[model samples]
Structures are given as structure tokens and as C-alpha cells.
Target chain A: MVSLKQLDLTDLSVRQVNEYLHGELLEERPAGVEILNPDGLHSIAAGLDTEVEIDILGHAGYFIAGMNQRARVTIHGNVGWSVAENMMSGVVRVKGHASECAGASGHGGLLVIEGDASSRCGISLKGTEIVVGGSVGHFSAFMAQAGTLVVCGDAGPNLGDSLYEATIYVRGSIHSFGADAQEEEMQADDFEKVAELLSRAEMNYDAREFKRVSSARSLYHWNADAHQEY
Target chain B: MCGIVGLLARRSDYRDDLGKLVTPMLDCMATRGPDSAGLALFRSPLETTSRRFALYAANIEYDWQSLADRCQRELDTQASLTFVENHAALVSPVAVNTFKAWLKKTAPEVHLLSVGQSIEIYKDEGHPEEIARRFHFSEMAGTHAVGHTRMATESAVSPAHAHPFTAGEDFCLVHNGSLSNPYSVRRKLESLGIAFETDNDTEAGCRFLEWRMREGDTLETAIEVAQAELDGFYTFLMATADKMVLVRDAFACKPAVVAETDDYVAVSSEFRSLAHLPDIKHAHVYEPAPEQIYSWSV
Candidate 1:
């Protein structure tokens, strides 16, 4: 039940603060918990099972709110790698650019990166809904098992390299594809998902402009000498 | 440049969370190191006598199976043949001191990486996730774990050129830069029966460390020796069950950042990945000195 604003976190490391507040804020926490300086440290608010409302003011580092079972983390600046990694549940919002693997391997949650994200934004991602207002780096969603990744800007190379069940909607050009990935015309279900994610991110974009990329599931297994086309 | 990551945790810790706590952190570098990714995890009840080998054989041909068979036959008695792939992990129940002697006499072309009880390795020719999905890398759960993501420069993409090259059990490596003077040092290791799988510069680097360690040097000393012997713009990361070593070559061409707190420590190729911590007001980030090697043992 500690508000991040009142917590005297000046004396401890980022990890130390996380350790100190372990399990103290959960399930709709008070709005006072706010981070004053967010440099490239890491794993802030990780393993939080509480529904605490934590607001960060600057750029953050990797695995922010990682493995978060519950809790709401909001960042006002750009974010680094895997912002909401392996999130079992909860909501994370980034007001600026997100580095690579923004929501990678996430299980379930709503992640909003207000700006661009670098490569592999949702790799091995499952059940999570990720929305990016800007472009994504190469090989985004390489092995996405399930869930949805919606990008408002351009996408980088090898989009969905080994895509699984997940669906990706990009408003930009795709660099290429691995053996099992391909670009498909957007459908109703795809439109719905993109619309929902964009709305969750509080973005107002035209869903019709995006294209869907998914797995062809053609070369799932290695034939070695075959064309290796997906 | 390349990025390498490994993990070794108590078995009790594994069943509790299923690698959920660490995989995302490991996957965070997919862009910084987009070429390829690989990881090996080893469980405890680990052996202290096993060795990890990094052979740098000369005149290696496309006939990998034949060469591997020859290696097995030559060191058949002392080296019990286990799984044989492009790379193999062996359990050395024999005395650690005598194991190299047996290898020198049997398969003189073998360059030992390290020796220990349990070992795991994964590598490939694409981005980290590409390699990870190809190998189902995250399935590995052990007390000891290590991973690498490549950005191919001096080496081509091939299985033989992949990392965690075995020289002995429990000793494994993932390198992130290139080596100069490979031919001369490779020839030296080859003279001592260190066989290589590919012409990749990293192979030579791994072999040099193994040879030094075999000559009665500790991991630190061996790495130091290799640092002296090899020339390159490199940053090499090697992991053992109880220790992790980071070696930055002359000029330190690659980027490496290390962050640690009382609870845990994490290292990555960039500063942004570590910026999210709640209390890192002035997150102290620095790079390794050229020709200097840093090691941490748990």
C-alpha cells in the first residue's frame, strides 16, 4: 500500500527499490507511486502481482515490469527492450519510442508503446496485445506463438520471420520474410484486433490502411535441400 | 558483434516459474545482435571434472560426419562417445588433469573449451529469435545457462561456426567480435591436436583459450594468455557453472554494459535495456577496458 511518490527511493538501486516494494502494491494501487528518474537500469516494477498504478517519467531499460502478473505501469518517455516482457496480466503504457523486443514473449496484457519499437517487438509472444504508434525494427514478431501486434508506422525487415499463430497488422512496408511468414490481406478478425489494440493504446488511426502478416506454416520443419520457402 | 547470455539456477527455482523471469530479459537484445542466437542450460548434480572443448581443426572439409567419427575413434578410450552432432558434449569421469593428456595422445586436433559436469549449447545463422525458435532454446532449464546472439563479421553462418564450441565438459563460450592472426594461432593449436570445425575466427579464439587452460592455467589465466596471444577487435564472454568471464580484445570495438544490484546483475549490449529500473537514478554504466578481462564467480 505504498505510493511510489512518497516512497524514499533515492538511496537504493532500481533493483533494490523493486525488491523493497515486492508485493506491497497490488490490485488498483494508489496513484502516488511515480519514478523521478528512469535511466537505463532494468527490471523496474518486475514481478509485481499487485494492481498498483506506477508512473515513470523518463526513458527506461530492459524488462520493465517483466513477468508482471498484475499492476499498471505507465511511462512518459521512450522505453528500452522488452518493456512488458512475459506479462501474464496487466497494462503497460509507454509514451515514446520502445526499443527492441518491446513486448516479447508476453503471455497476456495490453502494452502500448506510443512511439516506434525496434526489432523483434513481440517474439514468441502469446496472448498479449501490443500497439505501436510508430515504426518497428527488423524481424518484428519473429516467432510469435499467438496474440496480436499492431503497428501504426512502417515495419522493418523480415517481419514475422517464423510467425506462428499470431497476427500482425502493419501500416508500412515489410522488409522480407523467413521460411514460414507471409503478408496477407487484412480480414474482419484482423481489423477487429487492430482496432481494439489501437483503441487500448488510445491511438486514433485508420485500421484499413494496415496489412496483415502471418505464418504460411509451409516449411515448419527443415527439409534441408528444399526451396526453404515459407 | 554478438551477445551471449547464460543462466544457472537451483532446480527448485526452475519448476516455480518455467524460465518466465529471465527469457524476456535475454530476448531483449534481438536488434542489437540480430544475426543469430543460441543458449544452453545445464542442471546441477553437475560434475566438477568434465571439460568443454573448442576444437579449431585445420583443413576441415564438408564431410563433417567422417571427421567427427575420426575424432571419436582417436580419443575413444578416454573420451566416452556421447551424442555426436556438428557439436558434441562429453562427460569426463576421469581426472581433470589427465583428461587433456589423453586427448593430446588420442585426438591431438581437439581444442578444449572447458571441462565440467553438465553442458548445453545452441547457435545459428539468423537473428536471436530466429535461432531461438529453430532450437526451441527456452526449453532448457538448468542451474547453469548461457546464450549468444551473433552479428556475423569475420565469420560466415554455419553450424560448425556456431558457438559454445566444446573442448571439455562444462566449459562453454559465446564471442561477440573478430580475431586477427587466426592462421598463426590456429596452426599452434592444431599442432597440439586441436581440430576445428570451420574457418571462423572465433574457432581459433576458443581453441587458444582451451590450449592455455590445458597448459595448467586457470580460466582467468588462460583467457589472459589468449588475450596476449590473439589480436582482434573483440569482446568474448565465457561461462562455467560457477563463473562467468568477459574478455574485451584490444581496441574494444564492441559495446558491453553491465548492471548489478544486491538481488541480481544483468549485462547487455546497450544502455536502454537497463533503464527501466525503479531506483537507478544515476545508473552507473561503463565499458570494459581493452585487453582487459572481467570475471565473476558465484
Candidate 2:
């Protein structure tokens, strides 16, 4: 049987809970940590470097699971801004909607939002794999260096602005693309990648329905002849 | 950063518990803004001929009865006042111009917070929790209320600079982000011979909206104009006697979440502040989209 421990926030502050998560849990090695009554408090389960499965039972506040390492955390309710921001290597899944900047600046991780994600989702993303079951808001994947953002639903305006290397696959409509981001035909490898990510995210989208968006490479060089007119 | 919170109960059954329901929401947002706090409570409109004047003083022990007596003597009118700490709500049949002239001459030190048939404001410079307790926020009752906890970035940290900035009658506005074009907005309003009390950016937006309303533009129309004219980031929560309105900038650099149920509609800069509301578990919660105007009428 998996050892399950409950951390009820009614009697514990987030500081106390995090202290326990950071200190004793490493030694105790509980198989799972269940955080009860999160009630939209910020920074729950942040910086966890364990392989334990964590469950937050209520709506969580900003920066939850931020900078996560090895933990596989799941939030049962909605989350505030910057969820999983600056993550290293981990898997964080939000069952409900996420506020702005979800999975922002992550180095490595799989962040899944089953519901809609607000503006700037995966912003400045570096090598993170984000699969959204629902739509993504405006300016998503802006200035991304390297990653894969798969959207099963519509992509908002200015999607993947100033992109480099990172590939975006959208199964739904793209309202508009950013300056250097344009759509291309999905090849065999692209279908395989989208299928793998969708399977990991537990989404049911057919991989062939996805379209690829990548950099046009126009912004890579500075043009001295043009007088700043795009 | 600053915090903005507003609550409007849908049914009149919840009207008497408005303060109890909203005080904690205001207190929880102290993390976002801890320097000063203010609230504008909109009671049901009074059917009488008199208006209520919300007043504030720097010193908590200031003599309010003497000032009231002198006002009654000078204006030869009957007025009644209730004071708690440094704040008071005076009710009388006096015209706004007459009251302003009398206050300028007799009690220039006391600050006039708001004047309306329903709106009563209480604000001070301190920790929001302490100030909320001092003003007896939990005991007051109203149909709706708009509150703010301010962390001043572009202006002084004084009571006058605290949020829930009011202009004209029952209208008040609170902001979470800074405005970059306040000077130009202020310049245009000032050119029309309009006066200003503090050099706060939110006051500029508040006065501009009220001026537009006075010029026969509806509140929605005024906000549409503001969307075009106002620049910079903002998540503004505004209230009049019967309406609670919210809006965000086009970029939505700031954040606002709203929770609505059959009982009430609540708004905050973040969802954390609204965690403890009754029946919140089943409320339909969502973030207000960028550049959208959301209004709830009582």
C-alpha cells in the first residue's frame, strides 16, 4: 500500500506545510502527500525535489509547483498566475483553468492544463513541453527559445511571437500568428511528437488534426537597408 | 502593487451581512497592498431629502461634535453625525456647494471623503487589517461595497492618496496598476476649470469618468472613451450607487478574478482574497478578460 499523508491547511500555514515538505518528507519518504484546503494559497508544493506524488485538493494561488524538480504534482482545482514557473524537471498538471503565464520560463517539464489557460502561457519557454486540453490565450509562447506547445483548442492572437526553435502544434484554429511564427504542413515526425505529448497529457485529440507552427527566420538577421519598416 | 476588491449581493436577504462577508476579503488582500486601505459602502438609496457626507480626520481623537455644532450654527441647518475613530458620516439637507463652502471656511483640516445618498467611505493610512478594525468594517451593512488596499508607487502614502477615489456623488474607483497618462488626462480636466484634491493617478481617472457622466455619457460609454484615452496598465474596479463595474487594460499585465453565485458577485485582484466567501466552492469563478467591461447592476 502507498503511504499517504495529509497536510491540512486549516491548522497549518503554507510556511509550515512547505517546511515539512522540504525537510521531513525527504527522510520519511511518504509515497504521496495530500494537501487539503489549499484555498488559493500561493506556492504550495514548490521546489519539491522528490518523486512523491502530490495532490492539492483545492484552488491554489500563484506560483504553485514553481521551480519543481522531480515531483509529480496534480492540482484538483484552479490555479493562479505563473503556475510551474521556472520549473526544472517535473510534471505538474492542473485539472482546472490556469491564470496567466502558466509554465513560464521553464527549462524542462511537462505542464498540462486540462482547462483553458490565460494569456502568456508558456511565455519565454525554454525546452518545456506544455499540452493544453483547452484553448490558450493571447501572446502564448512569446520569445520561446526551445520547446513544444500543443494546443488542442484554439490559439489566441499573437501566438508564438518572436519564436526560435520551439515548435507549436495547434489542432484548432489560429487567430493570428506573431511576427516570425507561421504555419507549415505537419510531417510524419510532427504527428508522432503531437501524439506522444497528447498521450502523456491524457488528451484524446487525433495527432493528424494538428498543424505545425515554427519560426520564419526573418527576425534572425538585422537588415541595414530597411528603415525599420516591417 | 495594489489590491482591489468588490462585493455585491444579488438578493436583498444578504444585504445586511455585506460588511461581514467583504471585510475578510479586503483583509486577505493585504499581501498585495499593505500600506493603506479604503472602502466605499453603498447602502440602499435613502428616500429622504438629505445626503450623507463621509468625513475623515488625521487624529482619531479629533472632536467631531464640535465641528458638527459649528456647521449647524454657521449654516443654520440641522445635521446629525455618527463618528467612529477618526471617521464620521454626517447627514443633512445641505446642498453640496453650501457644505463645501462651509467646510472650507470652518473645518479645513477635516477631509471630506465622499458625499452621496448611499455611499459611505472610510479610509486611512496604516496596515489594512488594523485600519479595517478601526473603522468597524465588519459591523457595517450595505447593498454592496468596493474596497482597496494600496501600495503606493507613483504617489504619496497618505489618507488622501488611499484608494476608493471618489468623484461627484456615489461613484468610486480603485486601481491595481499604474497609469502613465494621468498628467495628460489631468491637464484636460483641469482646462475645463475642474478642481482636484490629491495628485494621485486614480483620482485623475475617477474625475475624468465622473466628468464624462455629467456630460450625459452613460457609464458604459464613459468607460469606452477611457479605454481609448487612458494608457498604461490597470485593472480598475469601480462602483456607483447601483452598479459594480470592472475593467482591465488591453495587455492585461495586471490580474483580476471574479466569482459569481446566486447569492453574490465578488471580485478581487487575485482569487486568494475571495477564498473564504460563503458558497464559494460552487461559485462560477473566472478571470475577467483584457479590455472588457463587466458590470453588475443592483
Candidate 3:
């Protein structure tokens, strides 16, 4: 039998709920937790380190499920900025659209946005697999050092700017690429990676239809004639 | 970070509830901005021969009836005043120039907020909820409204520095970010014989656009020109008597979320501020892309 705990934001403040999620819940380890009346407030289920299945019922504000570890969190409505930022491990899924910087700077995790993500999505991504069912806005994957970002829809301008190690697969049109980020021929591994992420996100797109983007490695070298070099 | 909001009612029934609808939107954005708040509401137009002027005075006990009498006695202009606290809405058949001159010579301390057939402006330095309550913002009925809650980054915290800054007749703009070259914009406009009321950065942008419109550019063209001339981060929500225009800068660092439905179009700096609108869950909510023009009719 699964024991479920529902926390109403109107009845309990976000801090008290977070303290509950952070402390006693770890010992009880309830199988499921539901957060009601998000009401576009900030930091609803942020900084969780649990294995419980958490669900958010309404629209949430900034940093909805940031810094997650081992929790399967789902937001049923749209989320504000930087959902699931800096996650070491977990599955954070937003059923609706996301604002800016979704899954930003996550060292590890599978973050999925079912709707369009705004500018700078996955910015500074260290190692997070982000599968977006819809389009992504400008400067997505900026300075991403590791991980894979799969965009099933169009990518906005400056996609994968200053990228490092991380790979991007966009199924639709790319407005433009940023400095040092370039579209490379998709290898077999790229197709496999996209296929795996799409299946995990429960999206239905042909992995072969995707294009890959990665760093050019031009800015990594030090030239004597370039003057200010280390 | 300041917050900006605008609502245009396409449905006739919604017009009567515009204030009741938008008051919570403004008050909800108080988290983003707590220093001051202002609103510009557009009602059904008066006669073409008549005009409306929104007046603001520092003295809460200022005599608006005496000012109307003075307009009759001095400038031979018939004016009616509807007042609450330090703000008053003055409706008259007076020529704007004649009324402005008369005001300058008579009560120099009173600030003229806007002039048009439909627009009425109210603003003050305080929390948005208090400002709304003081002016009875929830009781106002209008076709559309533009409002601002100012955190006052680059300017003082006076009521004058608060937003929904007005320019020419029936035009006003609220800003959510700072400009980098306001002094230069001010210098150029001053050379063109345009005067400014405050050193606020948003005032510079407002006057520049108004001056361009006066020089025969359409609002769209003036905004296009402003995109090049004005440099900085901004999500500008502008309104005329008939139109509400929203635009973000090239970088678009300042946030703007727009929700449009069959009944109305709403714009705000954040979705939290817009979450209270009727049937907002069904509205087409989306972030405005960078450097794009979105205009809606009242």
C-alpha cells in the first residue's frame, strides 16, 4: 500500500513544506506526495533528496524543483524559471511549458519539458539529459560542458553558444548557431542517444530526423599572435 | 525589478469589470515592485470637441473645485473635476494649450498627468495595494488599462518617478528595466525643443517616442526607431487611447508574459501577477519573443 501526503500551499507555507520534504519525509519515505495550489509561487519542491514521487497540481513560479536528487517530480502545469536546476540525479518532468533556463546547470538528471522552453534553457549544463517536446528559445545550452539536449521542435537563435562537450539534437529549424557552436553530421551514437531520450520523455519522433550541434573547439587554443594568452 | 501590466477588454461586458479584473493583477505584482504604483485607464471617448486632463497635486487637501472655478474665471474654460485624495480627473472643452498655460500661470505646483478624450491617470508613491485602494482602482470602469509597480532602480522614489509615464495626448508607457543612454536621449530631445518632467530613464524613452510620433511617424515606426536609438534592457508596455503595445529589447532579459483570450489580452512581467485573471488557465499564455511588436486594440 502506498501512503500519500498532500500539502496545501494555502494551509502550509512553502518553507514549512520544504522542511517537511527535507527532513521527516526522508525517514517516513512516503511513496507519493502531492503539492496543491502552487499558484505560481516560487520554489515549491526545491532541494529535495528523496525517492518519493512528487506531483505539483498548478502553475509554479521560479525554481520549482531545483537541485533534485533521486526524486521523480512532475509539474502538471506550466513552470517559471530554471526548473530542476543543479540536479545531481532525479527525473523532473514539466507537463506544460517552461520559462527561462529550464534544467540549467544540472550535473546529472533527466529533465523533460513537454512544452516550449524560453531563452537560455539548459544554460551552463554540466551533465543533464534534457528532452524538450517543443521548441527552445535563444541561447539554449550556452556554455554547456557535458550532457545531451534534445529539442523535438525548432531552436531559437544562438543555440548551443560557446558549447563544450555537450551535444544538441534539434528536429526542426535552427534560427542560428552562436560562436564556436556548429552543426555536425549525426553519427549512429547521436541517433541512439536521441532515441533513448525521446523514449524516456514518451515522445514520438524519428531519431534519424534530428541534427547534432557541438562546440568548434576554436576558442580553446592559445595563439602567440592573438596577444593576451595564458 | 519593476513590474508592468496591461489589460484590454474586447468584450463589452468585460469593460465594466476592467478595473475589478486588473486591480488584483497590479496588487499581485507588488512582490516585484513595492515602492510606487500608477495606472492609466481609457474609458469611452467623450465628445470630439471636449478633452480630459488628469491632475496630480502634492497637497492631499488641494481644492479641485477652486481650480475649476479659476479655469472659468481666468481662461474662460468650463472644467469639471472628479477627485480622490491628491489626484483629480478634469474634463473640459478647453484647448490643451490654453488649459496648460492657465495651469502654469495659476496653480504651478499641480502636475498635469495626461490629456485626451478617454485617458485618466492616477499614480502615487506606495505599495500597489494601498495606491489602488486610495484611488479606488477597483471601482474604475474602462475599455482598457495600463499599470506599473516601480522598484525605482535608476530614479528617485517620488510619485513623479513612478511609472505609466505620459507623453503626448492619450499616450503612456510603463517600463520594467533600465536604459543605458537616457541622458543622451534627453539631450537629443531637448535639442528638438521637447521638455521632460523628470530625470527618470523611462521618461526619456517616453518623450523620445512621443517626439517621433509628433514628427509624423506612426507608433510602430517610432517604436522600431526606438529599438535602435534606445539601448538597454526593457520590456515596454505602451498604450494609446485605442491600442496597447508590448515589446521587449533585443536581449529580452526583462521578463514579459502575455495571455490572450477571446475576451481580453493581458500582459505582465510575470505569470504570477497574471494568475488571478478569469479563465487564465484557458488563455493562450506565452512569453513575448525578443524585439517583436505585439499590439492590441481596446
Q: Model 2: which docking level applies?
A: medium
Candidate topping DockQ: 2
Residue pairs clashing in model 3 are none
Candidate 1: tens digits of C-alpha lDDT, residues B1-298: 5665543333354423324433554576676577666665555544454444323233233233454465455545334443322334455445665656765775565444445565556555566665565445555455545666666777676555666665554667777777778999989888988887678887788777777777889989998777778887777777666776787665444656655544334455665544443233343334444466777654
Candidate 3 per-residue C-alpha lDDT over B24-143 given as tens digits, one digit per residue, 9 for 90 to 100: 999999988999999999999996678899999999999999998888778776778799989998889988998998899889999999999889999999999999999999998999
Question: lDDT at B134 for candidate 2?
Answer: 89
**What's model 3's TM-score?**
0.96
In model 1, state the lDDT of residue A132. Answer: 87
Across residues B176-226, which tens digit of lDDT does each residue of candidate 2 receive? 999999999999999998899999999999999999999999888999999
DockQ of each: 0.20, 0.79, 0.70
CAPRI grade, predicted model 3: medium
Q: Candidate 2: where are CA atoms >4 Å away?
A: A225-230
Error of 1 at A218 (Å): 0.5
Off by over 4 Å in 3: A222-230
Per residue, candidate 2 scores C-alpha lDDT tens digits across A83-123 of 99988988999999999999999999899999999999999
Q: Across residues A115-214, which tens digit of lDDT does each residue of candidate 1 receive?
A: 7777678988998889888887777887899989888888876788878898889887776665588889888987887877777789999888889888
**Per-residue lDDT of A1-230 in model 3, one digit per residue for the tens?**
43998899879999998999999897777779999988788898899987889999988889988999999999999998899999889999999999999999999989999999999999999999999999999999999999989999999999998889999999999999988899999999888889999999999999999999999987677667867531
